[model samples]
Target: MNPPFDRLLADVLACRHCEALLPEAPRPVLQCHPDARLLIAGQAPGRKAHAAGKPFADASGDRLRDWLGLDEETFYNPRRVATLPMGFCYPGSGRAGDLPPRPECAPRWRAALLDALPAVRMTLVIGQYALRWHLPGSGSVSEAVGNWRAYWPRPAPLPHPSPRNQLWLRRHPWFETDLLPALRAEVARLMEDPAA
Candidate 1:
């Protein structure tokens, strides 16, 4: 992170545009670097991640890493992977699950943050909010994901890796049977490429 990028990131970290709607003091959790090759664009921090001040530090992260065939060292490496959720802080829980990321968060910050990462080669969009942002009007998560190849080697849509989605995974057997292997291969290639 250079001085300019550092300042940009600092601004993002200090964001509180939706502070009133969050579950706690805004503890924006994310990872970024100018050299990052893969971008993990997600909805927001889960309660566990908000507590840790780290993105994707829960069981859902475990499954996401498995899907990408990434070890923690590689996944957590800011130089290699960057994580920027729609909302940086935890939005609180609801009867269905975690609330949708605070609607105002991304519009205010995403573009500038994205501009800081010049080396991004691929993006893994997780859950509905991310899809809506990254691939608007692309249809449901399943539909966008089913059309993943069209975006090929970048911007792959994925269901949230929460255990709650076990049924979704079971229902969409082709995701594991097809997409995971391809995604893993690209991940390995990016991790190995020196320029990336």
Candidate 2:
């Protein structure tokens, strides 16, 4: 059966509501199959990803793959996992990090996207913005990510895999000890059986 999500995704890719506000306009990059079991919801693309028109094609991607125990090929495979962002385009950068994702993309597209991925068993919400949107009212990023056990079988908040956050990782050794193993195991299990 052709899942309803295909149509929803088509609509998302066609979206241009905030084009004028964008520095390079919205490109809405994402990858998924209707039957995907794992969902990776991130913040907007960095300059690299926006330019390349691929999701997670930078240093952050390397760390994300490491955390998930996936190679580039497996991470980009749509049948096993989906990579959708809070915003579709590069929202530029701030003094500390990249700017927040454009507001329109998620409000306009996220529900439809989530509705379409009915088989998704785990959602890795990367970065503060993604965690805020996916797990709203969950307090600060540290709070939400720290309480990873609560969002089991649905969404799991993760710190951004960017090298910029290396200091944060060093401070929080428990994340490596506590979360990475479980996250990797779940991802591996899903990749092994997309239907699971």
Candidate 3:
């Protein structure tokens, strides 16, 4: 790993600033490299991801990879893509679903970590928290995702690619027909040679 990135990652890995507040012990999870061209930002690690010590280690990840037109090897290749979330640890479940990512995470670590990724040409902001942080507005996930072009060529808001959102996917025919084609083409181009 590059020294600066290695240091930043080490710092993140060692972080336990909110361990006391977390339901379980802190276990930050993510994959990244300074050379990455595609940045996939999501809400936070889920229970499966936390246990696996990697981000997106469940059906959600499988769906996410499919959405990006990527296979596991390519999607997990840190040199080509970076997977960072709004929070690094599992925030535990709530009556509705997984609770919102901890309030402290972004304020503490977001900027410094993002700065390490100078080569990221496009950022796919997944779910509400990621969208709020990356593309601030009162707009709902559906609205921001639909208005993706407004933030084109840099950060694009997307609905969470969870199986739970299967209904949403069914409802939004345009996401598949309109946005994904362009998104995939860009990903394919970026994968050819991120260093370019």
| Number of the predicted model whose lDDT against the real structure is largest | 1
Residue-pair clashes per candidate: 0, 0, 0
Candidate ranking under TM-score, highest first, comes to 1, 3, 2
Candidate 1: worst-modelled 10 consecutive residues by lDDT: 14-23
Using Cα atoms with residue i matched to residue i, what is each candidate's TM-score against the true structure? 0.97, 0.93, 0.95
Cand. 1 TM to true fold: 0.97
Please give me the total number of clashing residue pairs in predicted model 3. 0
- The most accurate candidate by TM-score is 1
lDDT of 2: 0.85
On TM-score, the stronger of 1 and 3 is 1
Which has the higher TM-score value, candidate number 2 or candidate number 3?
Answer: 3
Q: Write the per-residue lDDT of candidate 2 for residues 1-196, one digit (tens) a residue.
A: 5746667777777888898888877777888788778899999899999888889989999889999999988788887779999898888887987888998888788887787887888998887778777889988878888898999757899988999888989999999998999988888888886457
**For residues 71-113, what per-residue lDDT tens digits would candidate 3 score against the true structure?**
9898888888899899898999988888888889989988988
Which stretches of candidate 1 lie above 4 Å from their native place?
A: none
How far out, in Å, is residue 117 in model 1?
Answer: 0.8
